[model samples]
Target chain A: MARKTTQTRKAVVTIAAWLIGIVIFFPILWTILMSFKSEGDAIKAPLAMLSSPWTLESYGEVQARSNYALHFWNSVVLSLGSTLLALLIAIPAAWAMAFVPGKRTKDLLMWMLSTKMMPAVGVLVPMYLMFRDLGLLDSRIGLVGVLTLINLPIVIWMLYTYFKEIPGEILEASRMDGASLRSEILYVLTPMAVPGIASTMLLNIILAWNEAFWTLQLTTSKAAPLTQFIASYSSPEGLFYAKLSAASTMAIAPILILGWFSQKQLVRGLTFGAVK
Target chain B: MATEHSRTAARLMVSPAVILLFLWMIVPLGMTIYFSFLRYNLLNPGMETFAGFDNYYYFLTNAAFWDALINTVTLVVGVLVITVFGGIALALLLDQPFWGQGIVRVLVIAPFFVMPTVSALVWKNMFMNPVNGVFAHIAKSLGLQPFDFLSQAPLASIILIVAWSWLPFATLILLTALQSLDREQQEAAEMDGASVLARFWYLTVPHLTRSITVVVLIQTIFLLSVFAEILVTTNGGPGTASTNIPYLVYAQSLLNFDVGGGSAGGIVAVILANIVAFFLMRMIGKNLDA
Candidate 1:
């Protein structure tokens, strides 16, 4: 009787959980569905909207209408560019702080994390004015610099946590083997650190990809990423539901996949390893 | 582990990042403070004079400032309440053994990956549009009036959208903490005849309190600066109804060209965020030793 009741309860719980999950996911699913329908059919009653014949017209129209490929390429460049730059600067710093037990390392790490808290709006005016003065406004290189700075702190923190887990004995062993410091890091450390570094890169890419505030404020038509590309749909002429859905779907699909892969690192990264 | 040679090399390796971050933090922030003191306007650049805090006076005394402040707090508090509580419920449900748990977790977490612009636009046009939205269709089919969600309840609608995006984050974090919970203790309590609710109240809530605090502080920091959602949806709209500090500052500086006034507003935002950051740093700092 007890086992039967437990089985029944599990079934009930599964149904309830699945129902709630679908409800939560319904908007994204709906957008994907709407992207397949024609513009006129997209805004129909929910059931009617879903039953309409699917089409690839909107996807083709999105690309034709707005040079979707350019924006997609821009997103790829900005996110990948920024993450790579941040990784270059952060790896050494995170390595030093993780391995070198200095008196101020804790304070230094905290200070770096504190920099992430300084709201982007707090510096918007000067950044805009400076970017304008430098002719950096709406330039991909300029936005990459800004994205790199903002995300650098997070990359360092995540790497620091990951690097902290690497045993010190290995480095000591390499040193005793008459390996130079350069070779020690190149051989002994790089292999062990690759997974952590990869995870950090993944999480940072998702962050920079979806980053809206600076990306929206900094870029215009020439350098706009998908975030800015999607925002263009807010205008009246861009209100076709099907096209908007198509653009949004394309904009988010890559990051959504990347995000799923980085779920474990996200908790560690965002929480500064506090939870994990 | 520390040799003098390595210490030097470590310092060298770290200097580039430190120097860049230092400049990044100081230069723009200094200019904002300097600009706030002058009667500057982008429309008439290089024709500025000292304002003697008049900009701050006007920005603070203005009716819009108070409204933005209130809206900012409400948005943060409202979203925190929903995501935290809703996250707790979802985490508890997912913590149970069930069929297709992985798929359900993925489905629930999908919204967080959708960019803010995409999520806000989708919710605004598809789900909340009164005339042709899913909600309107449902309402009409049920013999009720279709509700204009954005115009009638702009801030609340925004709160709902923001909460949906963040709920996954809170759930994922809390679920992680929940999984770490000692199963032996839970079963021991069960054997002791403790009610399910009692066991949860005593064991689970206590274990989750640290993560809950982390979630609240971190989310509060991000929520205070919500911009794109407001920008894309209502544009802080129906007359500043949804304007928070960031949007208000953006409008003041970028839209209105009142650089001095906007800088003042920006300084105020910095101070406000600093207060929250102070507490959050302490929390994360406490965890550092462990």
Candidate 2:
């Protein structure tokens, strides 16, 4: 009898969870649904909008109406470019701090995390002026550089956490086994830390891809990512729900997939391992 | 394990990241402080001169400054309240033995993945538009007037969108923390005839306190600089209703070219954010030691 009651309770809990989940997921689901509807039908009453005959006209219109491909390419380049650069700089530092004992290592990690706390606007003036004077404005290189700098602290901290987890005995054992220092690190440490590095890379890419502040302020036309392309919809023809949905869906689709994979890493990275 | 050669090598490996981050933080910040003391405007180049405290005076005295300050606080606090509470509720629900738990988790975290600009645009035009939006369609079908969400309640609408994006984050973190709770202890408490409320209040709430603090502080730091949602939605309008410190700085320097005023504003914002960061750094620093 008790087992039956527990099973019934589980069923009740499942129904409630699904209902809330669907409501929360409705907006994204609706956006996807709206993308498949006719423009006129998208703005119709909610039930009708959902039940209406679906079509792919808006997706084609989205491509035809704007420079969607260019913005998409910019997003891909900036996100991947910045993430790779940050990892290159962070890996060595994280390795040294993680494996090596130093007096200022903790202080250094804390200080780096503090830098992440500094509000972006606090230096927007100088950064903007520097970019303008250096003729780096509206260039992909400029955006990539800025994204790398902003995300560097996060990259370092995430890596440091992951690196710290690795037992020093492993490295010590390898060294005692007559492995050279270079090969021990290259062959042993690198292989062990690959999961950490990959997850860090994934989270960083999501951050850079969705970054709106620098991307919006720094770029005008030549290097504006999908953020800008989507914002442009606001002033001109944002009212076209079908095309707008199509653009938004496309713009967010790649990152959404990327973000899902990094959910566990995200909690760890963003919280700086506080909860974990 | 201890060798002079490796110690030197470690330092060499770490120098590049440290130096670059130091320069990135200090250089622009140093310039901003210096510019805050000057009467500089990008509109009229080469007319810069020392004007100590004058920019600060102007920025402090400006009515818009106060509005932006209040709006910034409101946005941060508003989003925190919604997301934190909503997060707890959702996390609790998801923690139950539910069918399709994996799919539900994926669905719940979806909004966080949507780019800020895309989410902002979608909500503004498609969900919140007065006449042609989904909300309007619902209202009209229910025999009611379509409410103009942005114009009527600009800050609230932006807060809603921001909360939606951040809710997943709060849920994910709290759920992570929740998952670590001792199942045996909870089962024991239940066997002792403790009511659900008592167990939840004494056991679950205490367990989540650290994660909740983490969520609140991290969200505050990001929430203080909420720019894109405001930019794309109300543009800090119906007149400064949704303007936060970041948007104000962006406007003063980039839009209006008031370098002095903007830098002063930026300095003020830095001071405000540091107050929160001080506590947060300490919290995470404690975790690092553990």
Candidate 3:
């Protein structure tokens, strides 16, 4: 009797969990499904829409009408560009903080994290004016610069936590073996740090990709990423649901896959190592 | 580890990041404070003059500011409440042995990866629209009136959308924390004949408190400045009904070209965020010691 009850309970829980999961995920799933339908079919009621013959007309329309490739390339460049730049600046700093103990190292790390707290809106006016004055407005270089600064603290923090996990003894052992400082760092630490650096890069790219505020405010035509591209559809055009879905599905698909891979790092990075 | 040579190199390596961050934080912030004191307008340039605290005075006294303030708090608190509570329930459910758990977890977390613009547009167009929306279709099928969500309840609708995006985040963190919970203690409690609710209240809740606090504080920092969703969806209203502080400042300066007034609003937003940041920083700092 007891065994039967436990199996039945598990079955019930499984069904309930799957039901809730499907409901929660329905929006994204529906969007993906709708992306394949014709404009006329997409506007129909849910079941009818699903039953309609799937087509790639919307995807082709989105690209042909909007130059979707340009925006897609822009997103790729901005996210990758910013993440790489931030990594270049953050690696040595994170390395130093992780290995080198100082009287105020903790305070310094905390202070850097606090800078991340400074709301972006608080600096919007000055940034806009400065960007305007410097002729950097709506430029990829300018967007990259802003994205780097906004995300630098997170990059450094994530790198710091990851680098901290690397054993210091390896470096010490390398030094004791008469390896030069350069070789010790290049050979001994670099290999171990690569995984952490890669994960940090992944998380930062995801952040920069989805960064909406600065991208929207700064970019108009030239440097607009996918976020801006999708926002253009906000004003209702007649029966463009399929096209919008196609664009959105394209925009989110890459990052969703990337995000799933980086889920563990995300918790630690976002929390600033608080929860993990 | 603290050798003098290494210490010097560390400082050298660290200074570039520190100097850049200092300039990044200070320069724009300084300009904002300066601009707040002047009657600056982009449209009518060269007529700028110091206006004392008149800008601040007007911004504070404005009816729109209060509405934005209230909406900001409502959006933040509303999303936090939904995400945290819903996250806990989802986490607890997922923690149990279930079929295809990994795939289910991925599905639940998919929303967090959707860019804010995409999510907002998807929710607005595909799900929440009065006509041709899934909700409208369902309502019609049930012989009920199709409710226009964004206009009828602009702020609340935005909150729901924002919460949907963030629910995955809260659930992910809470699940991570929950998985770390000592199974031995749970088993021991079960052996002691503690009811499921009793064990949850005593053991599970206490373990989750820190993660929950982290979720709340971090979410508050992000939620306090929700912009993209509002921008894409309601544009801050049917009539300023959904505007939050960030959107308010954006409108003040960017839209109206009222730099002085907008800077004042920006400063108020900074002050508000700082209050939350103070608590958040203290919490994380405590964790650093631990």
Error of 3 at B287 (Å): 1.4
lDDT of 1 by residue, A1-276 (tens): 999998998999999999999999999998998999998899888888888899999999999989999999999999999999999999999999899868899999899889999998889999999999999989999999999999998999999999999999988888999999789988999999999999999999999999999999999989999999999888867799999999999999998899888888889989988988
Docking class of 2: high
TM-score of each: 0.99, 0.98, 0.98
**Model 1 lDDT per residue over B31-121, tens place:** 9999999999999989999998999999999999999999999999999999999999999999998999999999988898999999999
Which 10 successive residues of model 1 chain B have the least lDDT summed? B281-290
Global lDDT of each candidate: 0.94, 0.91, 0.94
lDDT of 2 by residue, B168-274 (tens): 99999999989999999999999999999999999999999999999999999999889999888888898888788899889998899999999999999999999
Measured against the true two-chain complex, the DockQ scores of the candidates, in the order shown, are 0.83, 0.82, 0.83
lDDT of 3 by residue, A105-173 (tens): 899999998899999999999999999999999899999999999999999998998888888788778
lDDT of 2 by residue, A146-264 (tens): 99999999999899889989888888898889999889978998898999999999999999999999999899888999998888877854568889899999988998888888889
